[model samples]
Target: MAETLSNLFQQFLLYMQSGGFVMWPLLVLTIILWYAIGYRFHTLKRGSKKSVRVLIRKYLTGKRQKTKGLIDRAIVDAIEAVNGKCDGKRGREIIEDLFFPYYQDLKRYRKVISTIVMVAPLIGLLGTVIGMIETFDSLASMALFTQGGGIAAGISQALFTTQLGLVVAVPGLIMGRMLDNKANMMELELEQIKDILCAEKGLDNEI
Candidate 1:
């Protein structure tokens, strides 16, 4: 395992060297993109197979069992807000207020993930262009013919950035889309929670 890891690290270093300066920015973008993706994934996780109404019903019955996921926590909090000492606010307003943070959490890092996904491919293309320019410049100076593999190596190295950029982008794009969909679904579920809780007189009524 140690040997395999060392070999992988060596290959990664070589990949960075072959891609030139653009690889650095791509690497940073990859880190930020995945971080944002992971955060959004954690934030949007439902942590339960139960439906929104079922979870709400459970909370309404004062079942204070352990909570999981955004909705679960929000449901528990909303129930507390409604059942707690009245503070001159309607149950609906209180529930909405309680759910506001979860709403923001759902939206967080979404734009950052999307921006990285879109920019990664463009950055890769820039690297490719830069590489091609360098390759041609070397050729112009008769430096290409003196190299072991000459033009082929230059071209290969030039394309590496493009490949890296695409590698960074495609997965981010797919995961970002999935996260966005999950966020939307969670948003709707939050709204439903608000509605279901608000419709109950004291949250003691059945859904």
Candidate 2:
């Protein structure tokens, strides 16, 4: 086990050395993006699992009237504003007005995630280009006798950049897709919540 660990560490060290300085920043950005994706995932997961229906029912029926937090306050305001605009008619219009933005917000929550995922790969590509440039420059002044060594050094370093980019990009893309799905699922739930609320209020009387 220790031998395997040592071998992995040695390989990582070689990769870093071949990637040169630009790869370091890419590495840091990758770590930051990973943590951000994780954080967003946890937040979206919790958002999905939250009981918006019960909360709304409790507030609307007067079983729970206290404004406990920002989310609750938002819900109350939405319900009140919607109910008022509804002119106490208990129509679907009020429910639509109140929860459309909730659905929109769920969709928007993953917007930054896409940007982060896209940028990670581009950054990795940029690092690869920089590494290749350095490798070429080092090769230019080498003695003819050592031309093969120079070419090998340049090729190895060039490949390092590509590898680094993939290392960052692949995971970022995977996580981004996962988070996107979560956000989409949450939006679907919000829509369901909207439908339920509208029905409970008799707003769908037109249907």
Candidate 3:
């Protein structure tokens, strides 16, 4: 088993080396994208809950000891405001001020994912162009069809880099889009929280 794995690793290195310098950047991008995806998934999953609306409603009424998330904390703040005990805002307004920006903070890494998606394909194209130039240079002396070295290596590098780039990009794009959708869904839920709280406290009048 160890030997088999070692052989596979060696083969992977050979392929990367063949793909030339572009492979390094592509690999780096792939790593960064995957890391971002993992972080997004972890954060969203940890933060998500079922029947959050109900939990929020209960908290707003009187059960306000345990704060589950931003919504609950907002509820606590809102209650303080209604009693005129808070710093100067209603409970709902307190929730709104903190949560509105908190949502924006949640969306931070998403743009990075988007940027990587747009850049990967261009990097692949760059690799393809370099490979083509190398191949053409080999063809200058009618050696492209005859030479087994530069001409063949250039074409191989071209194909390998292009393929690697697409391979890196496709999954990153898909994952980025999926994470974006999740973020949107979370925003919608947060909006509902705001609406419910505001209705309970007449927050527009408070502010």
Candidate 4:
């Protein structure tokens, strides 16, 4: 098992070397991108399978159970904000104030993910261009035939960076879109929760 792991590590090192210095930046970008993606996923999860109204009702009845997911926490806070006192516009404003952090949380790391997705491809393209330049320079100096792998090696490096860039970007784009959709849905649910709380004339009775 140790031998197998060693071989895998050796192969990974070789792969990184082939992609040249740009591989380091790409690797860093990949790390940051996925971290952001993971954070968004964690933040956006709906923890409970229950509908927003059901969760709100559960809390309003003084159940006050432990919460999970962004919406679940928001609902609990909203209930506490009113505490069977304020209602209508006043209650909504308070709820909104309470919810502001959640909205910000939903937005966290979204821009970082987006920026990395956009930049990864361009960075890869830059590597490709650099590789091509090196290859042509070798050819101009009549070293192409003398060099170990010559044009083929340089071309491989160029294409490898491009491939790695696309690999990093495509998934980030897809995941980013999915997370964005989830965030939007959660936002709407939050709005619905607010409206429900404010409109309920018998909120105190319910509690």
Name the best candidate (by TM-score).
4
Q: Which stretches of candidate 4 lie over 4 Å from their true place?
A: 84-89, 145-149, 201-207
RMSD of model 1, in Å?
A: 3.7
Per-residue lDDT of 61-162 in model 1, one digit per residue for the tens?
Answer: 767777777788888887777778434346676677777889899999999998998999999899888778777867877786534335555676579889
Give one digit per residue, the lDDT tens place, for model 4 in 37-140: 99999889877789988888888887776677888888887887787556644666677788999999989999999999999999999989988887887787
The worst-scoring run of ten residues by lDDT in candidate 4 lies at: 198-207
lDDT of 2: 0.64
Ranking by TM-score: 4, 1, 3, 2
What lDDT does each candidate get?
0.81, 0.64, 0.73, 0.85
TM-score winner between 1 and 3, please give it: 1
Backbone clashes for every candidate come to 0, 2, 2, 0
- Note the residue pairs that clash in candidate 4: none
Global lDDT for candidate 3? 0.73
TM-scores of the candidates are 0.87, 0.60, 0.79, 0.89
| Candidate 2 residue-wise lDDT, 31-68, digit = tens | 77777777666555432224778777876887655565
Candidate 2 segments whose C-alpha is farther than 4 A from its true place: 1-17, 46-109, 143-153, 203-207
| 55: Cα error in model 3, Å | 2.7
Show where candidate 1 strays beyond 4 Å. Answer: 1-5, 87-89, 145-153, 202-207
